[model samples]
Target chain A: MQARFSVDSGDFTKAGSASSAIKRMLKQLGVKPAVVKRVVVALFEAEVNVIAHSYGGFIQCDISPEKVNLLVQDTGPGIPDLDLAMTEGWSTATDAVREMGYGAGMGLPNMKKNADSLQISTAAGKHTEIRMSFSLKEGEDGVS
Target chain B: MAFHRTLKVRENLCKSCTHCMKRCPTGAIRIDRGHAQVEEAKCIDCGQCMQACPHHAIAVEQNLFEELFYFEKRVAIIPAVFFAQFDDQYSESQICQALYDIGFTHVYPAELGIDITRLYCVKGADCKPIISNFCPSVVRLIQTRYPSLVPHIGLKTTPSHVTALFARLELEDKGVGIFYVTPCPGKIAEFHRLAEAGSAFNGVLNMDTVYNQVSTSLAKNKRKFAKEDGAMSFPVMTGSAATWALSNGELAGRKGRSLAIDEIHHVMEFLEFLEENEDESNIDFLELKACAEGCVGGILTARNRFLASERLRYWATSLPSELPEPLVQRIMKQKDAMMDKMTTPIHEVSAIALDDDIGVALYKMEKVRKITDALPGIDCGLCGSPTCSALAEDIAQGQASIRQCTVLRLKDPKEVNTLARIWGEKVTGEKGEGK
Candidate 1:
């Protein structure tokens, strides 16, 4: 099964919509709760990252009996330093964005902690595409 | 497996107007054979249907009034909200006296149990943002819909159950009957579930039933009770216990970052968000209730919810801040036993899952998505189902047929007929049509 959703740039109010929809689908499929939580948390962080930092983006989810794969592609001025962005508590968010209680610099790190495998493709002046996969088999990643 | 529920629809009184079907939060009700039918597994017994019915067709099952005579000593464990049901003219002692006149040998406020649990019961260091299990309907909703969050629910038993246990222990040798006077059908269902697990409760009496009897008794002996003293013989409760059934009542003095959410729809929305983002929210505790203003807004309640809540809050101010020493010592005597019962864990009841097997559930979900896309987007509720997606889900589950969609039948009869033949006419009244 596959589902796709678009995330508008700077739309803080609707950042978690895509994650919420995917969570509902995963729950209906009788996926394990811990796996669902991991998927949702990672997707939510990636979704918010696009809305807060990029121009605009879309999320695509592919689900199988054994695992779920996610692709988040955004049009933007990509990261100048990937390693620095992965560090906790390091952010470049504006003061106005910080007032909304977001941009805590936990997005990429939280996503990396939740997804079983994560890969990023980006340049200083190009768009960024993120790929993440979550294994659904019991006892994998301590899900059981 | 079918679970016990208290709400029922009278076939004779149903108008098939689709009022209750639309109001159900879980989409549990569906019109069948020109009458409303409830799917037992899907129902959380929130009483939304009872409140939405125009013809008064929905009724709550309760123990008969005469059932109180089964024991020599009948005790009524009543919530403070029950006293708020009457007009301000009726004093608490008058109502207590009226309960005796109506055959109750003793009257005890249900909040006394809250005091006991507060002092003696040791809470477990379970999941974060512990959900309060005070409201039975909210607990049922979580069990049926959000099964993953089951670990987050507090394991402590509710105040009424604690009070019933206390009452039984106090009168252990008296052969007493402990009856909970409930302001909602959910409590009756809860009592039944607890009774099956060897609880101390004997039966449940609807608040409206007992209210009518007390009103009659009070009216008949108005002059006789008017001259009596205003003092209450029953044990008094702490101020917080008096308002414990109201909205925000449970979170009044609790420590840590807590939130109290009332009304089923709002609670459902918040739970959906919390399920996904549990660790990020930083919430320490949650007090969720199904009714708008908590028990004061129960379907079985008599007075206006706001007025009743005000009365309870006002009454709370006149009471002591702490339980009397005698009451505290009584609770201390049974501390070990109460802790054993209170700490019992609540298991998940994943009733809403499409299938127990993940692979099969995934296939069914894909089918449901395809069917939903083909159907009209408008939630007309003309096909006996609450929404278009619900019908799609039903069809995928082999519980309904595509031919039941009146809109599709009207738009393209040939296409709908062909789809019905492919999907199988499993629905009643549509059989033998596609053959």
Candidate 2:
């Protein structure tokens, strides 16, 4: 099964909509609670990152019995340094983003920590594409 | 899968008006065969249906008043809100005396257990944004709808149960029948659930039932008893415990950044947000209740919620903060046992999942989505279901059919009939009537 949701840039009000919808769908599919939580946490972070940093983006989710794959792509003023962006407290978020409680610099770190496998491709002045996979099987991907 | 429920529908009294069906937070009620039916698995027993019914068709199940005679010692565990049900003219001691007159050998305030829970169970929670399990309905709601958040629910048992445990220990070796006088059906359902797994109390009584009996006794013996006419001296709780059933009651003196959310729908919306951003939110404690003004707003409550809450708050101001020394000593006697009992985890109820198997659930979900899209967006509720999406879900589960949608039937009668033949009419009113 598959689903797609678009995220408008700086639309803090609707940042978590996609993640919430996907979470509900996964729950209906009887996915383990821990796995669903992981998916929601990772997807929410990625979704927020798109809204807070990029121009706009869309999230695509593909679900199977054993795993879920998510692709988040955005028109971005992309990360100049991947290592720096991956750090826990480093951020390029504007003061406006910080005021809204979104620019904690923990978004990427959270997504990396929650998703079983993550791959990101981005460059300065180019679009960013994030690919994350979560294993749904019991006792795999630390879900049990 | 069988569970205890305190609310039931009287078929004779139902008007099939769909009021209860629309008010149910869990969408557990559906009109069937010209009467409202409750899907037990989906019901959290929040009493919204009971409050919504115009004909008083919904009834709260309670132990008979005579059931107190089963034991030689009858103890009534009364919530503080019960006293607020009466006018200011009725003193606490007068009410206590009235309880004695109504066959209760002893009367104890339910919030006395709050002190016990605080001292033993409220500290050292590992789950960030700990959800309070004080409201049995909220706990059951989380268990049914937000199963993933079950681990976040604090392990503290409700104050009433804790108080009952103390009562049991104090009255050991006696033929004691401890009854919880509850302001809501959720508490009764909680007692029943606990009783199924072994409980400290013997039975449950609705607050309205006790209130009526006490009112009658008080009215009959008006001006007959003195202000302090040998009323049983129960332990007085701290001011916090006195107002603990009101909104924001649990967060009064708690540490950390805590939030108190009341009313079931508001609680559900917050829980949905919290579930999606669990790791990001820094909340330390949550006090969620199904009733708007907490226990005072319970469907079974007698007085207006605002008046009762004001009365309770006024009463709390005069109370002392500390439990009396001897009362603390009595609680200390069973400290080890009470603490052990309070630590049991609440398990999740996977009642809302579409299917036990992932593949089949996915297929059913897809079908529900398609059917939902095909149906009219306006949720008329004329088809007995609460919403179009609910009907679609029912159809996917083989419990309903597309022919039940009155709008679709009105729009394309021939197509609807053909679909009904394929789907096999499941609803009672969907039979061939040549519409």
Candidate 3:
């Protein structure tokens, strides 16, 4: 099954709805609590990143018997250095976002930590897309 | 031993009014067979239900009064909120003396524990949005509901544990039993968790129970303590620490931004805000209290919270700005003996899952969603569950049937009967007896 949700830029109130909806879907699909938690955390971080940095984005998810796949694509000022952004404590978030506790430079890092496979494709001053997959099987811990 | 909650329901007092089911922050309460039943796995023991219940059915477990006599040396660890419970006629010393007069070998003020916790904890050291550990209900909420945020909780043992352990060392007697006078069921639950870990406290004494026991003489009682009256010993913790019982006291003197939130529902909302926003709030310290106005608003307390807050504010002016030398020296000396880890590991409190198997849980979720779409949106709680979604989930799980929904039955009898027959057939493999 597949589901898609639109993400609004700078809409902190609606920032988590997409991730939360996906989380509910995954849990309803009978995903393990541990697996659901990881997916939710990863997707939530990805959602916030798009909201904080991008003009807007959409979350596309595909759930199968073996795994759940997620694609978060955004049109905004894309990352100049993906490696630097992935590094912990490295952030280009504005002071306003920082005050809200969003720009700890840990969002992408957290996504990487919880996702079984994380792939990011971006071009400077254009767009960024985060592609991640989480395994559904029990006892296989998400990639740290 | 695994963590077990102490909050209980007296079957006779429960009217099955669903008052508690609506109030519970975790959705842990449900009406089963004309009685309010608490699903222990999801209950955080916040005592909201206890206060909400008009019948006074909810109660927490505690050591019997007769059991206090067994301890060779008994000590009463009193909370600072206990001082505000009295009129101006009674002094803190007088309450300490009255507790002694009431057969307690000694009275140790919880202020001492507050001081110890404050002194040792490094506020906003490494973890941002650091949560206070003093409020046991808030701690339990984080543990059960927000397991991901467990690392953010302050790692300082509560003052009760510190004082109890410190008293054991000072008395040099292993048989010295420490009894806590708590304001809410959550604290009692904390003691139960501590007991599993072999804590210094031997038992818990309810504040209302002890207040009634000493209310008569606490104001009138007098005792002289000019060095020679050695048995009339009580720890003197006169400082800003006395204000620790009040809301936002933990955030006092902190350099960074912070919030002091009370009431269980607000705490839940704030935590959700934190979680949904990816923990980005600038608040450094979150002094989250389950009660309305911190400890003073606890369900078991006697006075009004605002009145208590006023009294506490007036009392705070009289306290010393710094800790007394003796307490300072004692805390410095025994710092090593204090608990290094304070946050209690918690399990998921939500019972939203339909089955252990992911495939089965998915099937159940679909069934529940379909059932929920048909039911009335108004969450009247006539079906025993707190909300319509909850009732739908229950029906999908087979713990309940669609017939339990009085609204649907009355509003659309034909649809109700048709749906009930379908579900009944699914369950029994035959035609169902229509309601």
Q: Which candidate gets the maximum TM-score versus the true structure?
A: 1
User: The CA-based lDDT of model 3 is what?
Assistant: 0.78
lDDT of 3 by residue, A3-96 (tens): 7999999998787788878876764554655676788889989999989999998999987667899999998789898999989999999999
Per-residue alpha-carbon lDDT of candidate 3 for residues B1-435, written as tens digits (9 for 90 to 100): 245777899999999999999989988888988789998867877888988899999887778866778887888888888878887666666666677777799788777876766667634225778788888888878776665566677766777777787787777765687889998888888888877777788888888888887786653544442223432257667556777878877777778898899888999888766754444477777789989888999888888888887787787787777777876897777767664543344344433456767667666776777888888979999889999999888888777878788988888767776787666523223455212
When sorted by DockQ, best at the front, the candidate numbers are 2, 1, 3
DockQ-best of 1 and 2: 2
Off by over 4 Å in 1: B124-126, B227-230, B422-435
TM-score, prediction 3: 0.82
Per-residue lDDT of B1-435 in model 1, one digit per residue for the tens?
346889999999999999999999999999878899999888888899999999999999988889999889999999999999987888887888899999999788999888887798467536898999889888888888898788889888888888888888777737799899999999988877877688788888999999999999999988777533755778778999989999999888888999999999999999998888777778888999999999999999999999999999998998899988987888788776666776546667777779988889888888888889889979898888899999999889877778778899899888986777666553335635421
lDDT of 1 at B307: 96
Candidates' C-alpha lDDT: 0.87, 0.87, 0.78
Clashing pairs in 1: none
Instruction: Quote each prediction's TM-score.
Output: 0.95, 0.94, 0.82
How much of the true contact map at the interface does candidate 3 reproduce, as a fraction? 0.33
